[model samples]
Target: MEAVEEVAAPQVRQCPECGTEVTVHVRYVSWCAACDWNVDPGAPDPDRGRLAQVRRRLARRYGEQLAEEVARGGSAAGRVGADRSTVLAFGLALLVHGVTAGLFLAAAVLIIGGWHTGIQPVLGGLLLVAVAVLLPRPGRLPQGAPLLYRADAPGLFGLVDEVGAAVGTAGVHAVVVDASANAGVRTYGFRGRRVMFLGLGLWEILTPQERVALLGHELGHFANGDVRSSFVTHGALRTLGAWHSFLVPASRGNLMDWLLNTLLFLPRWAVYGLIHVLDGLTMRASQRAEYLADAGAARAGSAGAAVALLDRLLISEGVEAHLRRESVTAARAGGGSGGREAREAAERELWERLAARIGSVPESEYERLRRVSARRGHSVDDTHPPTHLRRRCLASADPRPARVVCDGPRARSIAAELAPARAALARQVIRDHAG
Candidate 1:
């Protein structure tokens, strides 16, 4: 089996655009020694749902506008202060909470009336159900979620705390590990405590300093006054999203079901509209939060490391693709009965294979990804601005020394702590992705 074809090149061809002799790396469409061609593999996930489509459209719209403004101006990290959206978001949140309170009150009144009149308290029960449906989902760790506490991973937690201090933010309350090629932070629990999620896939690929930068970025994400991260408005958004999801049917059903669905169409659409409006109202502010986080990354990890971290993000898709290919290869190697053994073998070598693939990314490929990033609306996700823009913001900023350092010994200690997780994640990727 070929090990990540993009990592190794043995083919050379003339450029279709310039007729210049070029080495054709399987990573991208084609490469020319003298000219750029259609290197852009636009929008990786195209077949998204209607709601997702709306979110992506809005993301690109806002991201492009912001990127354009930044290109003309100096930095993308412009401070957003007391923006209209923040006020509106807070008001909307209050309104949502008010509605919930009213429903509960109505339920109470009906229940009392039923007790006096000896009536069936059906309406009260129904109102209570509605209140339950509309309640906000507090961020909680999913059952069986992989956890890395300070006790189990003190060095990692210490590094994160240092980065948090450097970025001028409070330390996280919890750390969760997953297999995704991304990292993020969010508030959890009743008191809105914070948790930092680190994806081992991304973590393994990053340099020690880059990890510090990632932590800095995540730690600073909400501290820079992102209203979306505010637990108050967060409840509103979550409740509305839940309402929409609960009302919207995945498909049409039987006659009576269809009739009820038709009756609910307007209410369902209203909830959806609210969700969209909420997203639109806060998207620019959310993106601003991201740029601010990038600024904090530079502050905590040094400008160079922060910029390199963004550059590393450009190739994350490639890493995912490599995983998919490796999984398929592993599954197929066993054919029928031997698939399990083959997958186990693949699992054992997963980290090494991934490390080599990431290490082998050519400079030209990074440039291509960067260019593609610039051409597309700057976004790694709906809320994130583009990788190119983030990179530019970091690179163009005034240089600064790292506020926290991850020396060799500490790096080794952190790695040792993550060993079990890494091993489990390797099996997870193969098991989940193999076809």
Candidate 2:
């Protein structure tokens, strides 16, 4: 149950007529309070207004469903609920691994046993060896392992430990800071050790309270046992994908090659189809795990902060897009060595502008986001629930007050500790964009 990143929430905007902040209304229409400016002029269309109302009703209904599920102590209640689909997915993954392991074992036996036998056994051994070689190796950490920097900041580690303890999970084995705009926890290493990655993009935008909620949400995944199952399933999927690729015929050379390709096609197709089915089956449970983690976050911080964190993610999405565009534009404008610095400066400027804009966003916009998200519903590929459903579920759940462990000063210390790595990553990003 690695934490899955949710869609970015809605962004805040200023009044178009004047520079004054605007208020968002139903259907996400913006109006200037000061000068009577409206982003959508004229009276709110009744049809659009009705659609908004319908969206709200759907969100509320979904929220109620989630609340009732929580009340009934279903899968949403905690991490201990035994989900059959998850178990099935895990079992299927183990089955796939077992089959791969058997192939290797069979190859070993053929090679060893054939030493005293005739050439037939040796030929069989060689064939098995070739088959094993062709099979895709299990997915592992990337070379050089981007974003795997160890967190040495005492304050940051202390806060992480506190959050883990609060959420009833073993403390993370390591913390990583990445350049991406998302945070997640995944199990790594031979022993399935949990590692948490905090995105710098996400970090820059969040307030201390919101950050706490985010951390809690991630740590909660480990606490609920989602990490282990998710890691296994992910590994299995990767193995299956590799097998599929290997079985695909690169060329139709000779009769034997065609025969081999034809023989492998059915199995590969079956594995591919099985992967999709297992993925669909397990998706609901994965989503429930998300809601459970959200509940943990609500308990660790406040529901309000949890909801605000989701909103800020949307703002981060917009800011990230703008930054990338600006960086590329600057590089292409012939700034050369100075272009990198200019891009970084532009990034900082955009962040500040976006952060300021967050305050001016009308509450109605948040509601609109929730409504739209609710109406959209969950897709098979979605790892997290709709933002509005999450908000509603959190609002309905009981709240627990907790102190904010990673406040501004401590967060600053952490940024300072990781400054070198962040700088290196920034350069890499600049090069990537420029190239």
Candidate 3:
């Protein structure tokens, strides 16, 4: 008897909206390129609130404009001068600073001039407390991450220094390692000393060259000197946050309390408006700065590597989820009272396991990430432009060869330097997740 023939279903399907033929993947969203159907599969976060919604709208609008401009003519769109928005942003920041200064002067007068009046001291003390709350705190290095100096990790520092030079900036003064699925650079303390934070989760998954791309993008922030990161703007934002917290009226209790809150309504919302407008202005500049940084990424790590870096970032959510699962598994496997053995075993296979998962990602998955990113206007945050635009900008730019190359010896040396930090971080992860 002849056996019945079996047929496998095709991966292609029709879009419900446009009826256009589209290919579906088991692990990725299937979308119609022509109609953009299913391009945005994720739902919005209801808890993100109104302020977040406004910021995302601004990011999407400006990001699309910049993307088009970059596509048409590369550098000119990126060279947007301090426009009206920038001016307003700075003015608003200065106003915030001026308020802090005004508070100080008022407190001094009340305390010094009214020495004969007993109540003046009490009022002055309250004002001084207000001053302290409103004062702009400088950036601080993270306490959790282990620090590394140039001497301790010469190979890593040297590579960063090279990337910095390529991007036309001095390298970081110190390096700190963390277990996050991200990397960043920031000023440390009042002196504005530069420090770079390397996240092991993302770093472990990157090839040597992609790591260069990561460095390039971060150092590029320094070279470009994005307005939002400046002390003036950042300080203003922080101060605004403080003001918001301080002004939040207590819940209704009494008529006098209600009356007091009624009086504060204007001031409270006035600060709120400043926060929104200030963010609007600086966020635009920050997005533009991102394009400039992408250029630096291309120059330092090659256009291809830069694009690949963005693609890698697209899948970082998945990477984070995988890490959480791995953490739980590791905790369970440790099998001891404190799961000490589990921590050790997880650390032993941590990187290898992560690398294997990332390496096995199919091409279709990357494509899906790009599409979803485009539709949802995905970015690292409001400080960054959309990832799709970043990719497009890199693709449109003239192809560039890598300025800093990571060789086998240096890579090994750097890994060796990171060993202790990695182990400590692994143990910490297990401890946090262990049941």
Candidate 4:
């Protein structure tokens, strides 16, 4: 009997049910083995000049993105603020407070032992603890990651890819929608590179063009690493600041002890004031980061888009609805059914109120624009800067299409503009790293 020719186990057209790749005879039904992700392998219909423009932009900008490379060392792990670092800072602060306490206790012992000299040292140590506890500790820093999307329209994602490539950074990894109706980056995790919370309010309220621009703005954050740095900074401060509450009272008690526990209890108001100052600084830093990210997005061939997104976001009720919906959804997900329902009802009421306001638009050009916008499924209420102000800024900037080219000169200019920020961040990185 002739041995039957062995066939290679009837090689399937799809990947092994456990692998990530596969041999596909047709492009339409490719499947992944790793996680059961069946994908359409057919080439995407050609994007009418969009991908080409992105390629051109990337080609034009790649060389000038040297500054991004410099920033990579600090942001490389794609993790923003290290929670361990934060914990350490808090621990050190605690140790300092402990030492201060020990010194005071020793002073008391000495006082009882008739040795007066230790009293001043004890008071000084107590003062040091007071300062440590009263000063605002640093907060978590921001980390940047490539924007990734599983739910956005392909067109939108394609545009984001273009912008990301042009800006000379890794592409985005997640879609971060800040349901807070606030146009800002929302961060979590030690390496703040988790999600790009694009406010759903922006999506529910802006024109397609405006939505595109808002996405461009977020891409701006990715390119700049502002998101990551911001997270790290905030985390660092918060961690340190938390130690203050623990130390302030103990130090106060020590002072009271020195005064025979009768001089006066220093109100906790001073500690509160310190925290406020720290929060203000963090806010200011965040604002600056926003501006820079906006600028970067504008440079990525979508100044008008960014402008439109900002404008619509400022005046869209859809943003409010989106926020309310997210809150309800989150509440429900967290098992708070009754609370979620109440919030959803409240959101519906707010939407009705906003509709009434828009209905008041007189029969004029603004009304026509409103109708056109409605037809386009766009909203005007957003969470960031006001529309009028954003429009004015874009107008004053006079950003032309030609300027969007990430050419050598443009890159150099961007790098130069970012140098100071980068330097400051480098210092921070060093400090954090050393710590």
lDDT (C-alpha, whole model) for all candidates: 0.79, 0.64, 0.83, 0.43
Q: Where does candidate 4 stray beyond 4 Å?
A: 1-157, 176-183, 186-192, 225-231, 240-267, 280-284, 317-389, 402-435
* lDDT string, candidate 2, 16-59, tens digits: 66787654343345655466454234343245465445544444
Candidate 2 least-lDDT 10 residues? 1-10
User: Which candidate gets the maximum TM-score versus the true structure?
Assistant: 3
RMSD of each: 3.5, 8.6, 5.5, 23.5
TM-scores for candidates 1 onward, in order: 0.87, 0.74, 0.89, 0.40
Residue by residue across 1-435, what tens digits does model 3's lDDT show?
Answer: 011122333398888999988877555667777877766677764667877887788788888887777788754355446878888888999999999999999989999999799899789889999999888887787787789998898888989999999999999989989878899899988899999999988998888889999999999989887778888999999999999887889887899888988898999999899888888888778888888888888889899999999998988777767767777877666666766655676867766677777776767668877887876778898878889989988987889889999878888989998888888887776566554
Task: List, residue by residue over 280-374, the lDDT tens digit for candidate 4.
Answer: 33332233334455555566646776665454443454444433443444344435557555444433443233334333322332333333333
* Pairs of residues clashing in candidate 3: 334-342
For 297-335, candidate 1 gives per-residue lDDT tens digits of 988889998988888887887778888888888878857
Model 2 global lDDT (CA atoms, 0 to 1): 0.64
Model 3 root mean square deviation, Cα atoms: 5.5
lDDT of 3 at 104: 90
Off by over 4 Å in 1: 1-12, 26-28, 41-61, 64-80, 249-259, 328-345
